[model samples]
Target: MENPSYWAVVPASVRYDKKLRANAKLLYAEITALCNKQGYCSASNEYFAGLYDLSKKTIGELISQLARCGYVRLDIVRDERQVVVERRIWCAIESPFLPADPPPKNQGTSPENSGDPPPKNREYIKENKTSINNTPLPPTGAGIFAAYAGEHAGLLEALQGFEEMRKAKRKPMTDRARGMLLRRLQDLAPNDPAMQVRILDQSTFKCWLTVFPLDTDKPAAPNPQNDRRQVTNGWID
Candidate 1:
């Protein structure tokens, strides 16, 4: 009989994270292997969805959740046009056996010890201070939206209005949904201030997650003359 292949090890913390879904854990392991080999994982959402027979949105949600939970960090690379060109995924969990940076030569050695063979630096191994859950918070929706608003004052009121609408409707925005909407907005307008203004003007507060391009031709202005005519004709107060 053929020998069994070497098994991949899953961290106990990852396997036991109650907040982590089974699919996410499996994806994490796959991504961990890729990161270990190449220092990062560059798999697309479509690739993961097809591999696991899940929808692309589900994959995105899982990845976002994993990032929020500190199992991974996603570095989204955008082109000058503000389109996402690549996603570089990194394993955030620290490895127990990770080697520390080597100490500078002659720093710790005395003159008497210089003549003798220097003792091996075993501090890292002895200390082993790796903490798996010490991961920082991933980039969040509020953070990204705040950044956009900082660059574009025109978006501030519109975005705040959108937030109020969501609050009134009791619809909470998830990090994944927020990221998707931000990317879609960027893809639609890039750095065009006028186009972004038009898009926001035409946008309805409902369904904040979906972004649609602005229609051709400018939005029609409200006719104050028509309202006056209606009042004069006793149509309404």
Candidate 2:
């Protein structure tokens, strides 16, 4: 299930940690996002492995690395037989949703001469509607991207790359242009977010203003022997 409402925060310490691998950092970010709802994540290794197209063993290793760095805590549950049953991972840092510390007691007060600072004489300048339309324009593209992309990080990153490519080519995309580009990308890969990512990445790499259709390729023949031996081992959550 996808949760688009939650946002992840990785503190500077975790991002700059040299001991953690890039994928491990990404996993930490995922954990933080999951923790937003309940202060801890109960997702299994199989779930993360499938999400990232990696093996369960690899996901386990990454989680272990995060635990070893003191960035996360793992709680394991066992039954009467001493068999491992449930596992939960919690972030060590304070929850982002918690209220901030209160301001200092002497904040905004002065013993000798303080009330509010003296108000400066205010001069209201007339609005210039004719020569300069100084009214702030809404951020159209950002809103559109958020609405369309939701919490899909891969798609968002790919779109960002396309935007960067436009800037590098000295033809930065305007809000309308970016919105149109996103619509076109969706039409090109209607049901597939992964395909949309590939399309955007291809256009960015080739510095093309418009996206192109992917080439049609024949499917490779499958081997029955290999398929039969490709069973995944069962893992405890």
User: How does each model score on lDDT?
Assistant: 0.59, 0.62
RMSD of 2: 20.6
Stretches of candidate 2 exceeding 4 Å from the true structure? 1-5, 36-38, 98-237
Candidate 2, residues 60-155: lDDT per residue as tens digits? 889989989988888765433222344667777653331112113575665222322122301111110111112223336554454355435577
TM-score list, all predictions:
0.44, 0.39
Worst 10 residues of 1 by lDDT: 124-133
Writing each residue's lDDT as its tens digit, candidate 1 over 1-237 gives: 222122233578889999999999988876654442223566667567776789867887888888899877777665443534456776666553221122235757763343221234233223322221123234456655644543345675666566556666687677666666667777888766667666765664434435587656558888999999999999965
Cα deviation of 1 in candidate 1 (Å)? 26
RMSD (Cα, Å) of model 1: 14.4
Q: Which consecutive 10 residues in model 2 have the weakest lDDT in total?
A: 121-130
Which ranges of candidate 1 are over 4 A from the true structure?
1-9, 36-38, 96-237
